[model samples]
Each structure stands twice: as structure tokens, then as C-alpha cells.
Target: MISVYIGMGSNLDGPVAQLEQAILTLTNHTELHNIAVSPIYSSKPVGPQDQPDYANAVMRLDTKLSAIALLDLLQSVEQEQRRVRDRHWGPRTLDLDILLYGDELIDTPRLSVPHPYMLERGFVIQPLNDLSPELMLANGRRVQEHLSQLDTSDLVIIKEV
Candidate 1:
């Protein structure tokens, strides 16, 4: 089984509920199991701050599916949750991004493993640290180390949600 970390977020239509449903959806998939989720965080929108803030979190899944298959599953989940690609960084009902897949580094037209922006986004980094501080990347960098390199002072965890 390959270990994959996914970042989930939403800004529209009860973000927290959507995230919970997404997790349930993942767990219901037979090929995926042992899902570990980080605490939910409220983050300021990345691209356009004018948009509603997003509730974000990370999930670690042990799955028998290949990277491409996992990507397909994620897309299907987004569609099930009514995610629309209206604009770049636009508001959506759900956003599921594969942050990392085992120790693999992949660059493909359909999907990129070890997500291209995993290290750069505080939303991704903070939850990653929460889930597994000692988790190491393919490049031998720890989750806590990457989080330390980021400015996450503005990121706030929403414990109640």
C-alpha cells in the first residue's frame, strides 16, 4: 500500500460539512483505508483575499490504487461534492489536492505527485505538520522542517468545526 497525503478545503456551502463528507467518501472507498486527518484550519484565501476564507485540512490515506487512479478518485469526489472550475483559485464546494504520494516525485500532464505547491502553502504545510511532524519527503525534508520554513503565523486552526 502506498501512503498518500491529500489536502482538502472549501469556502462555499458549509465548508466544514463538505470536508467531513469528503473524508467519509474517501473512507467508503474499498481500496483506501487508515485515513488520518489533521485539524481543520481557517485560512485566508490565497489568490484573491476578497473571496471568502477557506477551511482547510490534510488527510493521509493508505491506498492500493496507483497515483493516476488516486487522482481520478479525487476528481470524482470533487465532482460529487459539486466542485466547479469557474476560475483560477475561485470559490468552490470542494478542493482535493494530492500533496504527496509515498516517496515518489512525478510530473505528469494529468496530475503531479508531491504536489507542486505543497511546500509553499501554509494551509498545506501546517496541517501536514499536525498530521506527521516527522514525516519525511522524497527529498529527505521533514514535515515540521518545511512548516518551519513557512510563515504560518496567520494560519488559525478551527477546533470547533
Candidate 2:
């Protein structure tokens, strides 16, 4: 099994409930095991501040599925949660992203490992640090190191997992 970190977020249709149900869906997946979830954090929306703040967390999973397959599974969960991708970084019911896949560096049309902007986003870094402070990204920076550099003034821990 390979270790994978997934970032979860929602800002619509009850963000907390959306995240909780998504976690259940991931934990119940047949190919995913040894699930670990971080505390949920509330943060300002990344774009279009008109929307509600987002509830976000990071999840760790040991899985037998390939990276693309895992991405597919995540997308399915989002769809089940009624995710609508009508606008970039717009509010949604769910957003599941593969933040890291072990130590692998992947950049394909369908996915990008290390999540492209995990280091720069406090929403991703804060909860990620809660789960694995020592985790080294594919780019070699430690999770806590990234957390320390980010301005988390807009983040608030809403719930502990």
C-alpha cells in the first residue's frame, strides 16, 4: 500500500457536514485503508470572497490503488456530494484533491502531486501539519516548515478529528 495525503474542502450546503460525509465515503472505500484525518479549519475563500468561508482538512490514507485511480475515486466522492465546478475556486459542496502521493512527483494533465499550491495555502498547510508535521513534500520541504512560513491569520480550527 502507498501512503497518500488528500485535501478536503467545502463551503456550500453545510460545509462541516459535507466534509464529514466525504470522510466517511473515503474511509469506507474498499481500496483505501488506515485512514487518518486532521482537524477541520475554517478559512476565507481562495477566490471570490463573496462566498462563505471554507471548511478544510487533510486526510492520510494507505491505499492499493494507483494515483490516477485514487484521483478518480476522489472525484466520484465529490460528484456524489453534488459538487459543481461552474467557476474556478468557486464555492462547492465538496473538493477533494490528492495533495501528495508518497514521495512521488507527478504532473499529468489530469493530476498534479504535491497539490501545486499546498505550500502557499494556509488552508492546506495548517491541517496538513496537524496530521503530519514531519511530512516531507515531493519538493523536499517539511510540512511544518511550510506551515511556519504561511500567514495563518485567516485560518481557525473549527473541529478536531
Best by lDDT: 2
The alpha-carbon lDDT assigned to residue 106 of candidate 1 equals 89
TM-score of each: 0.96, 0.97
lDDT string for model 1 (11-126, tens) is 99999899999989998899998988999999988887778989999999898899999999999999999999989998999999988899888898988878888889999999
Predicted structure 2: lDDT? 0.91
How high is the lDDT of residue 42 in model 2? 93
What overall lDDT goes with each candidate model?
Answer: 0.90, 0.91
TM-score of 1: 0.96
Segments in model 1 whose C-alpha atoms lie over 4 Å from true places: none
Candidate 2 lDDT for residue 113 = 88
How far in Å is the alpha carbon of 146 misplaced in model 2? 0.9
